[model samples]
Target: MKKWKRSARLVDMTRQLLDQPHRLISLSAFADRYQAAKSSISEDLAIIHETFREEGTGLLETVSGAAGGVRYLPIANRENATKLSRQLCAQLENPDRILPGGYLYLSDLLGDDRLVREIGRIWATVFSGRGADVVVTVETKGIPLAYATASHLGLPVAIVRRDSRITEGSVVTINTVSGSSKRLGSLSLARRSFPEGARVLIVDDFMKAGGTVQGMIDLMGEFRAEVIGIGIMAESQVDERLVENTVSLATVTDVDVKNRKIAVELGNLFTQGGFFDGTNPD
Candidate 1:
């Protein structure tokens, strides 16, 4: 058998593992495939894991106890992440989609099954093994994307409400400041909405001043669930406060009605890596 350099072989292995991170394969299997010593294979896995962490793609976890094996997480390589996000944002450039009050109409994009599924897949990839157990969102518009993301993660969707529906029976309600508003409004959660300690991914259609995001954050606390991450369809870049560890498909600066143009910029989520360059291996 021809011997391959450890660096080259490790890169190749990383690609295969990332393509299916949730699937586990034995160390012996990897060693046999590479025709390398078990020790060498283990070392290669370590190097790949370390590099992946450094790149913020995801984790390489070794399962212990019976039925244990090495697994790659479906985390995004920075470049792929950026490119995916940029593609979503670019769709906003259509002048026809612009609406009154500086809003960009995006129901058409969100309603597209393929685009929603792709967006969901990207979110799932980012939070793949970070232990997010449920996806949560407020009512109406955010439901489709939230359900799409939940489906990819194989998790349940928890709904927070702007107003409680009597059909849900008794509910828990909490009052807090909405994004950018000094006045407090109530956000409600249904009884048994989620099990305690379930990690949550918050999704929404748009984030303007973050009031809605904050409402969801507060709601999560009431359920004793932790927010693993937040994802948004798009963000109004003009309002910076709405974002913090939040990923958006695009950031809009100005929706120019008079000029028949919308000034959009790539959000920081894409710029940190991936979208700008193809440096990520997977």
Candidate 2:
């Protein structure tokens, strides 16, 4: 690497940290890259950490000892999370999003890169300390949300398909009943996509009675994987859920198809732990 000014070094360092997410970079690596002293690198890290905290973006976690350094932990403070929840609530309340079966359209919002990324940050933040080895989701719509969360958590994603495809190679299959309609369906996962006895974090686009989520959990058991956490973008209000112990961003309360109305509110984001202090949001 060529010699760089402190300003240039800081910018590059920040980029490297963001790009790598949970991968730790030794202080010496940064120091050698910019031909700066170890002390100088430490100072730069402090400055970056302060900025990250103030913006409610993430945190720079430092490790001590000769083999230790720092890694970026993607997280959203309470203030940032509240803003995102409100935005989601407003967008979801649109009556035009209602479909024939009273289902709300989510493709547009999920396609919004900015919104999806922010939601992923929250998922990653909320599930950070759970020690999940991989992010798992059923195919189709849940793929993007799984990848988004995986990116922030620095883990690989395993996709589950509604049907086994030759393209998926050897696979394990499971049969499940739809919690909403009581319809029967099958889900399959590539045998090699996930390792046996791995810790899993399940992510999904939406949930009604959690039949799909339950199916995934049952599948995980087949692989001997322990599911550590579950994150859902939204969940429909139901009298009884097939699954529980989930963190959802929003709840779809009422969808009056006749009146073309939708009611949505923020879901259990704050009740869980690891969020920044709410007294004085950043």
Candidate 3:
């Protein structure tokens, strides 16, 4: 193999780190791959680290010792997060998005790859230090968001199914009420999806009265898993929410179907101190 020059090596290294966020890569491996000294690799990493921080892209953490390595953490600073939230809010405020029964259409936004990935990055940044072992979401619409977030966190995604599937083998099921519709529903999870006492981060496409999210929380209890955090792409403004302490990227403040009007704003994520301010208390 041809020895890679410093410039080429830096580009390749940056790609590797960004491609696999929250994963540790040893300097020795890079040194061997590039046919360069460990000191040279360290310098290359330092440059990448500085660029990532200055650009608000993310952070590189160094682990020292015999088993030491560099880990890339994908986090967007407060300014970038706020900018993204505002942009999404603008997109969501279209009058055409107003649906019947005071719901807003979001399938297009959730289906967009670029938008979903960015939202995933935001959620990952907010919950990075929560010691999450897996990202959990209900089947269907929330699956993409869950997988995107799990990719950034280097964790597996565990999906809760509305109905039990035979392929999933033994499963645990729970019953809960929908806060908006006030209808009883059941959610199930595979027994082997995660280990007992796992710390889970729940991600969902939308939250209306927080019923679905609250159901997921109840399902987690059946497995003896801990709910570390909950992230929603969008939430509706309601007089009362079934669940509390959730991070949302955007809020649907109003949806006047009769008048064909809609309103959107940045959610509690901005008003909430820790995540919005780019400081995580864990």
Candidate 4:
């Protein structure tokens, strides 16, 4: 590749970093790609790093040594996370979101790519240091959230199915009770989806009583996999929670169907002190 101007190089470098999050790009590789000296590549990275910090885009961690390089971690600061959470809460407060079964309508929100990406960034931030090998989520509604999170973490997504599928090959199925209805249900995961004892980060669209999340945890145990972290988009108030230590972006404090009123608030992720500190409760 021909040598490019600093301005052009900066643009290209930023684009590359943004395109591949959580990937380590050696300075030597960048130098060779742009046909520039290591010193020049380092200078370019410094500028990009400062800009990322100022804009709260995320952190660019530089590793030194022979195998050293730079890794991008997609994280949202507390202020930005709180702002996004509040906006989502306000949107969710709409009475039209109330479904017949006392469930909140979140399909529209999940369908929005931009919103899902932002939420994914938040989830990535919360579990950045978990050393998660894969992101897992149950089939259907949570698949998008799981994939979005996986994109930022640079990890593969392992989807659990509600029923066994022939295409998935050998599977492991587990029985669990539905939190909302208390009905017995089964979830299955393909045996080839992940290796044994893999560290997994679990993500879900919503949590009423954590029954589904608990089921996923149980399923992970079958493979001897570690549940490094769990993230929930929204969790509703429940008298008894089947799971604990979950990080949630928003909380549904109250849902009054007859009065058409819904109370939503920033979740424990905001109130919890260790979220921005990189200390996961899980």
lDDT against the true structure, per candidate, is 0.77, 0.90, 0.89, 0.90
Give, for candidate 1, the lowest lDDT window spanning 10 residues: 273-282
Query: Candidate 4 lDDT, tens digit per residue, 157-214?
Result: 9999999999999999999999878989999999999999999999999999898999
Question: What's the CA error at residue 89 for candidate 1, in Å?
Answer: 1.9
Instruction: Kindly list the per-residue Cα lDDT of model 1 for residues 1-282, writing each as its tens digit.
Output: 767788779878987786664567788778777898978888888888898777755668888656777887645555656666777767888899877766678889888987787677677776666788889998878989998777666678988887888977778888767565466777888877777888999988888788778878877887888999998878886444844678776788877898989767776555566232444455
lDDT of 2 by residue, 38-149 (tens): 9999999999999998898999999999999999999888888888988898999999899999988999998988898998999988899889999999988888899999
Tens digits of lDDT, candidate 3, 70-122: 99998878888888889999999888886667667778988898888888889
Q: Which residue pairs in model 2 clash with each other?
A: none
Q: State the TM-score for model 2.
A: 0.96
Over the full model, what C-alpha lDDT does candidate 3 score relative to the true structure?
A: 0.89
Q: Backbone clashes in each candidate structure, one number apiece?
A: 5, 0, 0, 0
lDDT ranking of the models: 2, 4, 3, 1
**TM, every model:** 0.70, 0.96, 0.95, 0.96
Q: Which of 1 and 3 is ahead in TM-score?
A: 3
RMSD in order of candidates: 7.1, 1.9, 1.9, 2.4
